[model samples]
Target: MSTIKARALVLEEPGTQPVLAEVDVLDPGPGEVRIKIAASGVCGTDGHAIEGTHPLARWPIVLGHEGAGVVESVGEGVTGIGVGDHVVCALAVPCGTCRQCRRGLAEHCNSAARRQAMSGVMADGDSRLRYGGERAYPFFGVGTLAEYSTVRREQVIPIDPALPLDEFCLAGCGVITGYGAVMNVARVRPGDSVVVLGAGGVGANVIQAARAAGASTIVAVDAIPEKLELARTFGATHVVEASADVAKEIAAIEPDGADAVFEVVGKPELLTLCLSLTRVGGACVMVGIPPVGSKITFDAFTLTANRRLLGCRGGAVVPARDIERLVSLYRGGTLNLAGLIGRRIGLDDVFGALDALGKSTFARSVVVF
Candidate 1:
């Protein structure tokens, strides 16, 4: 097979920082497509992998999952997508034959989870990337941190070419995860009261989704004053600084407590607080990913009230369907895609972007390729 030389951010091992380096990409095999990445969004999940907090991130892998690109070529057996198509690379590619997928729960495909635990290669057990001619794993099968990527056919969702690729790239992960949590997982209805903790990338999207859902009262809680301000622009009806009295403050807005509480900060304490802030028969949705093996506890009495604590995976998204829906929302002006982008950066600035995640005032930093 012919080789394509490209630059990529490679995580040589766990506990070490990722570095920009040269790599060789192989052409797409059967049922795959090669993408010329246009933009990639820096996500908290990437930070977790760099910090060695994520359990499924294999070492010697390329970093990045939320990305957008144009299809460069298609391999044998690939249908529906073709060369020159604009697409978003989905991190979670469902194996249609898996038990979860067979049952219509493709978002939680067990085969995908199992694959994530192994080396970051395709199902064929071959590496699409190589460093110095040695096999290298590409994170989540679509390492968009690079100029080019090879991904399974199912992983690429075709999108409108008119949309700005740099901004729309967020739909691959952060946008979909947050928006789906409201529209799919929690199913926030009109007039519902929603409280979201953490006003960052995902939280900002959640605020907008709630507004689109016609939520009457949307409260955003975060320690950063700037993030809270950004949340307001995304349609937060109320903003509360995260503190010891946060639950009490939310209760004041919705005396019966919020209809749904979303914990985007993956802390055990915050998870518990989410449940407490939820009204009787309300749902506490967990959107943030906590460290593996972390434990959370709550009072049994709270459960008796019919308050539910639920975990959401990628917002239970079926990427192909949801990406198109979110793009439509963006076009209709119901969703603010441009507002979510704090800055446009380059591939070399990825590490700096990850470092500035919580400290920076921006909701998301996109690497414009």
Candidate 2:
């Protein structure tokens, strides 16, 4: 296959905004597949990358991870996936032989760490994209903000072709991360009471997952009334406007406090607040990605009261398994995949979508090709 020139959203440097530029996309390498990206979501991480706040983001990179597309070509040794297949690109491309993968913690696979160190390039330490003859990195190995992308075979998980690529694209990242935090990390059981902070994209998924788990009381908290209202559509039984008295309100709703509190907002103080909302012996799951090197403080005595604090990466998901399970739920109408999309847009509006994300105005804005 010949090199394909495509318009991509490229971050040229730190402390600068991303721009649309024409770039050369190479053919799939060994064990790689080239995809015609159908849709990609504007996630908070994308905003962070544009602002140079994300620790792992490398400049002169394409910024997008949550996406779905049609496979255009496959390299040698690929199996169970092929050209013409519809697939969701998972950010957690695990190496099955890694220690974390062997222990069933594929989200934290050792290969991911190695790849992250390379700063958005593929495992080969070379970029698949070039602009003006200069190498450009593809964010998280799948830069879906472009017309096409070349990604590792392991990163593309085949899904039902009939599913709407724009909607199902969420299962690749935000949805999976939030839902997995509740189902896999917190492990909220039936009849449990849960609290989800920051009812935006990921928080809404946490609420939905908690409800699916049969949680009797699911409290959603957000400073924005609109977000809290939107949270209810995703199964938040109670909504609270975030304030100094928010914890007291949650305590009143669940007198003994919640069984699990999910902090999906990366605010340092909110981390402590979420832990405060968890009942003694309950779990506090941190699902949000805070700025690198940011720290939080909590009382040591309170932490020793059998309350557990945990950090979840991509909801501890095995993408190959969970993406299929999420798709099944979406197919059954049990998961409200369509409702999570706030708006559909084209690539030209990516900057505006990222602005809306910073303002917390929408749950998710999808860029449809």
TM-score of each: 0.97, 0.97
**Segments of candidate 1 deviating more than 4 angstroms:** 112-119
What does candidate 2 score on TM? 0.97
Q: What is the C-alpha RMSD of each candidate to the true structure, in Å?
A: 1.5, 1.5
lDDT of 2 at 196: 91
Give me the candidate number with maximum lDDT. 1
Error of 2 at 206 (Å): 0.5
Q: Mind giving the per-residue lDDT tens digits that candidate 1 earns over 1-369?
A: 466899999999878878899999899999889999999998888888788887767767888888999999888899999899999988666767888889988877768544652346676778688987788887777888999988888889998898899988999999999999999999999999999999999999999999999999999999989999999999999999976489688778998989989999878778888888899999999999988889988887898999888899889888888998998899889999899998899987887898997777879999999
Give lDDT for model 1.
0.87
- In model 2, the Cα lDDT at residue 127 comes to 69
